[model samples]
Target: MKNIKLIIIGVLITLSSGCSPELESVNFEEISPAIFPQSEDDIEALVAAAYYPLRGAWWDGFHTTSERGVMFINDATTEILMGDFSVQLYATFHSFEPIHESVTRFYDDFYNKISANTLSIDLIENSSANENVKKIGIAEIKCARALLSYELFDMYGPLVVAPLELLKTPLNEVPLARLSNDEMVSFIEQDLLDAAEDLLPPSETNYGRFSQGMARMLLIRLYLHQKRWADVEEQANLIMAMNHYDLESDYVGLWDTQAPVDSNEVIWAIPADYAGTSENQWQLMVLPSNYPVRGGWGTIQSSWKFYDSFEADDIRKTNLIAEYVGTDGVTYNRSNPGTNMQYGPIPLKIAEDAARNTGITTVDIIVYRYADVLLSKAEAIANKNGVPSQEAIDLVNIVRNRAQLDDLLLADYADIDTFNTMILLERSHEYWCENGQYRADLIRHGKFSEYNIDLTGAASETAAHKTVYPFSLDRISEGKGEFLQNPGYN
Candidate 1:
């Protein structure tokens, strides 16, 4: 891992310091493709470069698992996280506009990665490496690109994805418009499908590298968003048929410092370490500044409305701290709530890393899990059937049972609305703070604006157009009127 990081760093430096003085005067007789990617290691490093943006690094990583990351931003927009930070306040109230830095950062920082992946794919394909190496390398890069695209698309609709030809001519002033919805979906769907053909199964792949399971999982999510019920069911069942994943019996154990990176439940987790390439700073995001075990900025907290939605016996809620003794020798809870607890409970999802002297911990940042596949399958089944199905009920029970909760009876959910409500709630309880998909789930069910208004009266500002965030004002201005902002933002 360290070697891969080093190789990526070297590549970045070379790319950034274009036309070095040492090479400027010396023209090569032949710039042969054979000279580069001559071995599997070269291809591996290129693949690692594509994975860099998705890492848990604090500065530029899109999936950092911290305040600057997708999980925090997306979860904050939902009921899962509430706080006084500008981003949190804006997201929580759905009042974010095109100029808001936090809301626009994902697009501004990482959208170019789409072209980066395209360039990498072109490089790997044109390299003199063997077919097998090229196949695997291209597949990994495609998957990484597709995953990033999906996240961006979910948050801010279709993007102006520049093609490889356009990327090649850096000086060209070719302004492009965002892809239409169908074109955008097809673009991402095709990449995942093509990549899955060569991606290794979960059992065969490295812990953090993109795998066939991850590709399929992304497909399921895409299908879910499109409400393509049968498609969701098919893709989810494909993963299940691989028999490469299952739920971790102990819910909280999945997030422990000692948790296995190769757990059956985790379809994909970013392997994090305090030292380097990837870092998981979730512990520092929610823990209060004066907490006894560890101190954090206390940037965000889970709402009581969300906390109360969980059943008392649900082990998933165990990590939520309703009260805690501070290092200042003060006890705090909902009633005597200190600064942190004023909004709600401290959502310390991952176990506290007591040995850590820094903000980051060694806990793997889980992205896709087998539990999501199961729940997604259940949702697809119920929605496809247009009512509660025993199959769907059983699937939901599998997850609930892991949470140490009683099975929900099918008869109880007579209609699709009730069943969907239950499914949404179950999703909220099960996957909160993990990937921030709960907000997407709400929007999918046509309840994003309504739910926020019900939970926080101030969210009355939310509207249908707010479902997808606006393109940043700078991006629109840069487009020279060729690119248009998402509707209603104007």
Candidate 2:
């Protein structure tokens, strides 16, 4: 696993640098499958390469490839965050523009990763390796592919669920039509279920590796998106039964840069080198201009509405720094967005590391946490019977209590509608920039549009077609009329 991490780091650096012509000149015949996978290390290396794209989705610092910008994409587009409108050229916040570079790059790179994952699976499955390696390796790669597919589906609806057998087929013979939205969901669910069989439970696998916990956690999110309330509840319970994960007792320390890497709260986290080998670039995007540590680009900050949404005494409010004394002895008020270099409520959840001026930090990018399971189970149960159950209220209180806030009783909420609204709000506070789950949360509650947000030119309600984003113009051009772009873009 350490070797795999080193390989990932090396690959990212090479990718961040210019391409190599010498590397390109090497013939495909020199690296055919027959010669590779002769050893376990070789197989692991192949699997590691498949996961390389996951890091590219958020880190690597490249303008076109770094998905770290997704932090801006998810938050700025919603009502919870704000940046300079002039600087918000990506259009995820201002308007749903199909030509946005980040959207196109994100879409293209994810598909590229899916292709890499498929090829990795083909190589491992066909190799004469130990059966256990084949099983677990293939399972992990499949889960990785499923994760990428889920994100793609979330962003762009009804994309091609590329056939596994196509791994063996020539590109010229491959078909590229997309699955129906329902078919795509089923395909992803089936893939995750199949993956769960061979994976160890959470914390049993290597650091940064996928596990049964991640599989079921993802399934819970999938079911929630589909409004499969019963399934969501069942999946969350299944994860709890695993008994390998629980919330970190110290809610504030969980986000601390120096927190333990093995915190029980984290079900799955993408590892980064605190020593600066590999890093999460989010701090570079979110920290204010004059923060105590190394400071950052100050591109994104919390919206005043989001800052005010928290309870006055809630410890989670520590995630938002309303005012702070800078190293330069200037007292900054983050509540005012109009002043020069001033943006409302800075998201200090991801702290800055003073050691590196490059904006890279040791913070692990978390994908799944046990607290989310609790909150999700709460929401699912409340919706199960169209009324907030005692169990639902108790589950929510578990999260709230951890945040040093008082518990809520069933009487606090007037009806199921009100309870559901609070649950979504709780999720916004707890999981802010963790996994991009908040977007799905908003869409699930039917609040993902201008109806809830205050964009200047937003339509009265979000168009049904706008729920899923449009296909990039490059992808459409590459398909050359074979692919159908999402509705409203054309």
Candidate 3:
């Protein structure tokens, strides 16, 4: 079973890295920047590093709802998996620890390229390069910086200082500084703002490059998270007005091989293809199986909590889970609705395709999309105004209409608390597999301990510093100068 899943996982990895092709090489002499000016070739090498790897652990490793359970930091899994010993004093909350520990590799990886990008930007600003190349290069840096900072913030949170001046200051001299969350967010906002102005408007050639619309989409997300209602609504309207993309009619087909790129739903996705080792989302996804029935590899399974929330009417419920009978005739289900006495449940969010005969298996992992923008706008409206405000309810209805889910009541029989609670459920139901937000959704709503029946063993936490992940000791040892080890880790 392991080997079967391994092979399937291999196919996934192969597709992701563009199936690296054997190549011929050209010879050139390398010279120091002090001796000779930077050339387009030199700039390309540096930016390529940042461009190559974009997935942070959270972004890629714990990407799906089924696998993303660890990030939620609750006791449900412990109760189910470790029934008797959950209250043990040794249990901890390391998920909240800062990410600078394990993430230094990505920083080193991208910052080196960012250094080169900075040089390229300087050349563009001062030198006699073509206007198009200069604009493109500037846009590229902004795009690259946005990607890096987004990764950084999600993992490490805001530090107290700015990150850019540390760009080329040499490893030893860099001081450890933490940007406040507000400061970190401000910097990220600035990067997208710069990109919006520097980028070409959306079109074909720019399809491969950053565009104004992408920047705006990014801004839309930032505003949503920051609770900026008006800005979120405005940006969403702007993108929708442009009409470049439409939601894929078939929800299942959004992941299907023939899923057309016709819709404006996607703003940016990590470019993936079925030819390489470095880029497959499936490498980490497929569960191994050996029976005559549809084979599957069970690396991670869905939470009973998540599966229970899905209504019978929602199409997304089908997309998020798969039910199967094992070779042993065991019904595989964890979230078996307490009513079902037998069986286990696997993630239906991604499957081994209906047509496996073609060997066409590459999955496009979405980073952000338009539906999120609308939700963000709706949430923002609710945050700024009360839950029943027409605009907030209306925006929420748009999403409900698309998903065919029920809407908030027109009459104000219940208070805002009731409406807000409904909104949270809708967001959870609709966006479960889209982002690593399901578990966080549980935490935000304070419900992991409730639905989780098997929550007793390691679910108990005795550690003093038990909210987040700890910065690994190894990261500091790897020349991460001045970076503080997160409070709870070591």
Candidate 4:
């Protein structure tokens, strides 16, 4: 676990060759504050490449030195420990156990590049480039930096507050110690806010650069965490005003590879070029034997809780899951086990044919989908005066309409408690496990204490203070105490 800090605060060096015959001619100097712009396009391309890891795939997917694979262990708890035993490594990560090991490494790997990204702004400025290119390069780096922090803070921050015993031995390292849940929240918020100022507007960044829409989405995310109701409303409204995005006629279009970027409700998205550079989320999420065999390397399975959240009345349930065609050659699932086809909502949100990990394809995640913005509006309205407004009901209904549903009933709630609960259920039905957004959402609504209902048996056995994970002892060993442990895990 000592390397946890090393991972979190990753280094940026020439991709290592292990057997180095190093040259000293390339000067390593401080980044100058000069503003230049020639490298802007290069910066944009780099940002596009960075988005791959977030999808839980390979290449831009999970890097081994990092805890990217460890998350597989953590997510498995929701499935293997809680669901069917079809996958083993899945449940091994229950809570902090698997998480501690992988995340520490991931932190180092992620930060190393991100920290280097900061220096990128200065390099292009100093390079023989124009002003627009340099400025844009810096902006892209800012966005990259925010994305990296968001990933870490998303998984470990609140969940694993520290001063933890930290991992010691290679095998049995973690022990426990203080709480810094709120502190973690602040650190994450600060990064997003700083980045938003420098990010390019979604329209300007073009195909794969950070845009205003991304910034706006991030703002809403930060505000939600702080319980800054009005600010959430403000940012969401500004984004909505852009009028650039509209819900796709078919909700499932968001995941279609044939679909163009920003054609539907997507405000900002990564363009996974299955053609050149590629990735397949199916490799990480689909079943082993699915057609073409999504790399036959299924790691992250969908949770029944996530699937069941949809009311049979909601159309999203059908469109979101795979069209289960079993050995019988059916396009849909059989209602009963005896039937030829059996299906329980696999990740249709990823590429269909790419369901095999071995396939060459890339699937973009909808970072700031239109529906998400609408929902943020709904949350803001409902959180006002500790009571939901009719405005809140309107927001929910807009999404419901897009989902092919009728009116929502939240407007009738007599008080804030009922209204708040109603909004959460709405959020659940709309955004569970989509982008690993659920964990942060749970905390936003102030239910972090009560919400991690991980049926993965180990969560039940954990110490009450076991919420925040301990720092990786590997990090401590490498970092020499530069990074502190999370609460209670030492």
The best candidate in terms of lDDT: 1
Error of 2 at 311 (Å): 0.1
Off by over 4 Å in 4: 1-93, 98-100, 124-128, 158-198, 290-300, 319-325, 328-345, 354-357, 446-459, 462-467
Query: What lDDT tens digits, residue by residue, belong to model 2 across residues 1-490?
Result: 0001112112322211111111222222346566666566556666665555565234432111123445546655565565654324333354565776655555654565666677677778788888888888888888877887887787777676455565444344443667787998998898799888888777677667788988888888889889999999999999999877787888777655674567877877766554433457766776666677777777666666777789998888786777767767877774333342353677767655666776666666666799999999999988988989889999999999998889998898748989988998899889876676787788888877743345424432346666766777766765646677887878
Q: Mind giving the per-residue lDDT tens digits that candidate 3 earns over 1-490?
A: 0001111001112112311122212122334334322455434433333344343233433222222322222222321111111211112212233343332333333333334445445544664545666666677667766655654455444432323344334343444445567877887788788888777666542222456777787777666555567787788777767667556555555555543345456665544444432233332433335323345433433444455666777776675434545555665445432222122234445445545422224455555666676666666666556555677677777777676767755465145666666666676666544544433333344444443323323544424333223444544454345555556565
Candidate 1 — which pairs collide?
none
RMSD of each: 5.5, 5.6, 8.0, 7.6
lDDT of 4 by residue, 149-216 (tens): 65665545632222212211224334222225566556556655655666665655555446777767
Superpose all Cα atoms of candidate 2 onto the true structure and report the RMSD in Å to 1 decimal.
Answer: 5.6
Model 3: runs farther than 4 Å from truth?
1-48, 55-127, 159-166, 169-172, 203-209, 283-288, 291-296, 327-331, 334-344, 354-360, 412-414, 437-468, 475-482, 487-490
lDDT tens string, model 1, 1-490? 0001112122342210111112222111233444766678667766766777888888878888877899998898888888776888888888889889888889888888788788778777888888998998999989988999999999999988887777666666677888999999999999999988999888898667788999999999999989999999999989999988988888898888985766898888877777655788988888989999989989999999998999999999999999988888889999978789987999998989898857889888888899999999999998998988999999999999999999999899979999999999999999999888999999999999988898789545789998898877888887877788998889
Q: Judged by lDDT against the true structure, how good is candidate 2?
A: 0.68
Error of 4 at 352 (Å): 1.7
- TM-scores, one per candidate: 0.93, 0.87, 0.73, 0.74
Model 2 stretches with alpha carbons more than 4 Å out: 1-29, 56-68, 85-94, 165-167, 171-175, 274-277, 327-329, 334-343, 450-452, 455-464
Model 4 worst lDDT window (10 residues): 15-24
